[model samples]
Target: MVLIDRIRLCLEKLLEVFTVFLLIALTTIVLAAVGFRLLGASLHWYDEVASIGLGWLTFYGANLAAIKRAHMGFPGLVGSAPVALRASLFVISEIIVIGFFVVIAYYGYLVLDILAWDRLVSLPSISLTVTQSAIPISAVLFILCELLSMPGAWAKMRHGIDSEHEAIEEAIRMAEQDLQESRS
Candidate 1:
């Protein structure tokens, strides 16, 4: 259990780093695109590249959002349910989400396999598989984060913050604040 926890932590940190790098690349690409447009020399592939980058950014950003519990949920509907029903619903929902991602990861793997036989249109140096690979990677990361977050959700259900949830929440809040400041 301890080793598993450590591995989860390491994986989460790695995802965080990867997300940051993608965000930086997205920003740079957008800025460069803007600059090129200003000079009346836009790269024909800039829009396509930006679109792909945006997709990667959104997917990775979702994993980060899950880590912070920032992903939207139907809390109001859940709140109106009876206690026993609510608990069951919550568990079922998580299970469904996990299962859904597992399917997505599987299909993503298939897409990646197909892409292995092709290359990007403009970026021949990069395989299409490399781009599509983010799908399964992000899906698995999301599943892991969701599982790790179960204890926190359980804590909230008991109307209290477990120490683990509190610690993770505090870290997430701090990181969010830093991100906001950087953006400003």
Candidate 2:
């Protein structure tokens, strides 16, 4: 379990770093395209390349957001719910997300299959399938991150020890302890 957790953390960190780099690349591509237009030269494929990069950025960014709990959700209602109800809601929500991703992965596979039969006219550098492949890949990774977060969130709700909240509480506790010790 520890090894799996460590591996997941490492993969998450690596993906985060890679997503940052992809964002940088996407920005560079867009800037280059704009510069070419100013010079009366058209970057014929720059837009396509940048679009693919943007797709990758958005997909992996979603995964990173899931890991960080940065994705926007309607947590206000859940937050106000009673303890038992909140736990039940959290578990149900996670299950629903998992099921949704499974369906997404399946549909993504079908789309890839359909795209594989067609040839891209303008951007011949890569196949349509390659571009479409990011869907299933991202969906799978998102599911994995959500699965990992499930246990931690479940444990936290059970004990009311959310790590982010607990960190703040611990900082305050330590500060208070320090003050008491100094006065003594």
Clashes of each: 0, 0
Error at 64, model 2, angstroms: 0.6
lDDT of 1 by residue, 97-125 (tens): 89999999999998987889787777777
C-alpha local distance difference test of each model: 0.80, 0.82
Location of the lowest summed lDDT over 10 successive residues in candidate 1:
157-166
lDDT of 2 by residue, 1-184 (tens): 6875786688789888989999988998899889999999988888678878988999999999787665766555666678898888888888898899999999998899889866556677568998889899889988988877666667666665555555678899999999999999
Q: Which segments of model 2 are wrong by more than 4 Å? A: 161-184
Could you tell me which residue pairs clash in candidate 2?
A: none
TM-scores, one per candidate: 0.77, 0.82
RMSD of 2: 4.9
Clashing pairs in 1: none
